[model samples]
Target chain A: MRVLGVDPGLTRCGIGVVDGQPGRPISLVDVFVVRTPPTDDIGARLLGVERELERMLATHRPDAVAVERVFSQHNVRTVMGTAQAGAVAIVAAARHGIPVALHTPSEVKAAVTGSGRADKDQVGVMVTRLLRLDAMPKPADAADALALAICHLWRGAANARLSAAAAKVPVSRLPKGSAQKGWR
Target chain B: MRVLGVDPGLTRCGIGVVDGQPGRPISLVDVFVVRTPPTDDIGARLLGVERELERMLATHRPDAVAVERVFSQHNVRTVMGTAQAGAVAIVAAARHGIPVALHTPSEVKAAVTGSGRADKDQVGVMVTRLLRLDAMPKPADAADALALAICHLWRGAANARLSAAAAKVPVSRLPKGSAQKGWR
Candidate 1:
């Protein structure tokens, strides 16, 4: 399934599209960034992001959208801006009837580099190799977006399989203690 | 000026509209909440907020929008959702060319109750008295939103006067020592 990954930010938001599924080679479809002037009013800045994301959703038509979830940050202002930008992306996808997934930064790193603690350079290198790009995507946000899409493609497909498998299992076959274990 | 104030949240976003100027007594136009089910997907929840806020903006056609600036919270998830909801309100206002202002929780409380650290009950009581309502607005969110609009009406008017006064001052006429002080 095709996936659109967004690294949301107020000044610059990254958007990348990747086509692939579990056990299949992934290919990069497109990558770009939408930027707003820092001096602009907050409302105008948000509207710019919303409109650009809406345009991208209409142009790409990805099967699913993956957004980098805003976690805690040293700067509360930055966290708020990121969350707002992320919300615009989420709402854009929802308007298009595209399922959206939120991936933590560490989760995206782990999926791309096999290390949750991997740094930006490691993520960039791995994303380049995974997508078979001639060079690294400029503006670290672009590489990060690609990594997010790759993560969703790999993880989402696996999740779907697990869900399908669980659905096919007969209720009578469930282990006596399975209910207590809880599905994580 | 008519002002629309928003207290944004994922489950329930409070919206209130008030009409008046800085010195004049403010009158409440309307107050209500838009709610989304917790069980819904995050994308769907965000979309619900965006659409509702848009509809409110269209119906009210307020001169300005005031949003409660989401502050840091112990729960990261809650903060993100609040920030996202606030962004939707800001964008909806922006789309209609209505200037948007952000007021911190403490600012709203102080404006309504004369105490930045006032409790919820104090805020609700002051808001009801300020609006000259027979009873308090149901749900603390509704009162909070009304307080936010009141804050914006009073504060925004004062801000405009300050800006206008500053604009009238000529830099060249300032005292030599003023250059070192810098313009605030």
Candidate 2:
């Protein structure tokens, strides 16, 4: 399934679309950032970001959207902006009837790089290699968005399979050791 | 000027509209809360809030919208939801071409009760008194929304006047005492 990922912030919001399914190679469809002017009114700035997100949702038509969840632990001032930006992106996807999945920064890193503590450069390297891009996506936000989409493709697909397997089997009647294999 | 004030939260977002000019009796036009279920997806929750805000804007057609500014210093987890909810309100107002104003909690309290640190009960009592209502508005969020609108009516009007006067005056020509009065 195709997935769209958004790395949201006040100054610049990253949007990326990737097409792939579980156990298959992923390909990049598009990546870009939407930047809002700081001098504009707070409401207008947010409205600008929302408009861009709506446009992206219409243009890409992804099966699902993944957003990087905001944590309030770092950057006290920008935390509010990041949360607000992410909210607009989530709402845009919902309006289009596309399900949205949120992955924390570390979750995205771990899913793509196998390490929750992986730095931005490591995540960027993996995203580039996975997508087979000639160059890494510019402006860390854009690359981060791609990593998020990649994470959703793998994790979402795996979870779906597990659910399907669980639905078909009764725990008591299941064969020995089947549960572990099914969940895996 | 007509103003719609929004007190935004995750579970319930308060929307209140009032009509009045500077130094005049403010009358309530409408008040209500949009409630979103926590069980719903995050995107769906935000979309629910946005849809209600759109309806309010369409119904009231207020000249301006006021939202309580969310701060990160308090309620670490809920702060993100509050910011997201408030962001949607701001974007909705902007979409309707309504100027948006934001007031801090302390600003609202000070405007209504002459004390920045006033408690919720004090703010609610003052809101009821100022609106000349027989009973206070139910739900503390609803009352706070009204207080935000009242704050905008007073502060927004004063700022507008200051801008208009500043535009017409040559600062050098103003008398010493007149300058002080003009600002106040």
Candidate 3:
């Protein structure tokens, strides 16, 4: 399956496309960053991100989209921007009926470098080696995005299979469980 | 000028539309809430918000859109959802080429009531009186939304004029002054 991964940001959003499935050699199809002028209105900036993402989705036609889930940061302003950018990416994918998965930074790091706390340099190196690229992706954001896609490919494929399996079980045969409770 | 005001939330987003400019008697055009189930996928929930806001924009054809600016809260999860919802509203308005403004919660309360720290009941009472409604709007979210619309009519109109005035002043004609160096 092909996956488009987005590292969402207000000033520079990174996009990467990879073609592969779990336990397979993933090939990098493309990678780019969409930057909006910092001086622009917030609404305009968000719209620019959304439009660029929509364009990428149309062109790449990825089966799924992976986005870096926004986590709380010491800088509230930065976190807010990241969250807004991520939200736009999610909406863009959903509008196109593309399955979207959110991977935490640690999860991406672990999936790529086998270390949850891997630094950017380590993640970049591992991504380069895994994708068999001659050179590492430029701008840490781009590498991070590729890492997200790779993580989703490894994790989301298995997740889909599990979900399908669960769906097959009849309700009467379902195990007793607590009601799902959590904000999306 | 007509304005659509949004009180952004993930589960229950409040929307209100009003028609008037500063110093004029504003009339309520419409008010409602858009809700997404908590159990829905985050991406799908965000898209639902975007679609609902888009529909409201098309129906109201408001000159501008006003959204309650999300503020930092103790609860990170809650704040993230609020910010995401607000981003959707802002993007919807931008897509339609409508000007968008953000008002702080305190600012909305102050505009609708005499005090910035007024309680919800006071804000609701004032909104009912200002809109000349037979009774207060149901659900506090609905009333809060109408209050936002009233606040925008009172504050955003003046702010727009000031912006227009500033834009008209060419840089060469601008008074020699301190460089712009602070948030609005």
**CA deviation > 4 Å runs, candidate 3:** A161-183, B160-184
lDDT of 3 by residue, A86-118 (tens): 888888898899988888899899999999999
Q: Which residue runs does candidate 2 get wrong by more than 4 Å?
A: A165-184, B164-184
Candidate 1 CAPRI-style tier: acceptable
Query: What tens-digit string does per-residue lDDT give for candidate 1 at A1-184?
Result: 8999999998889999999967879999999888988778888788888887887778889999999977766577777778888888888898889988989899899999999999999999999999999999978999999999999999887777776787899978877755311000
Best model per TM-score: 1
Candidate 2 positional error at B48, Å: 1.5
Candidate 1 chain A: 10-residue stretch with minimal lDDT: A175-184
Estimate, for each residue in B1-184, the C-alpha lDDT of model 2 and write its tens digit. Answer: 8999999987888999999987679999999998888777777788888998898889989999999987788877688888888888887887888988888899899999999999999999999999999999989989999999999999888888887988798988776765321100
Candidates in order: C-alpha RMSD to true structure: 4.4, 5.8, 3.5
Q: Of 1 and 3, which scores higher on TM-score? A: 1
Give interface RMSD, every candidate, in order.
Answer: 5.9, 7.7, 2.7
Query: How big is the RMSD of model 3?
Result: 3.5
Which one wins by DockQ: 1 or 3?
Answer: 3
* Model 1 whole-model lDDT (C-alpha atoms): 0.85
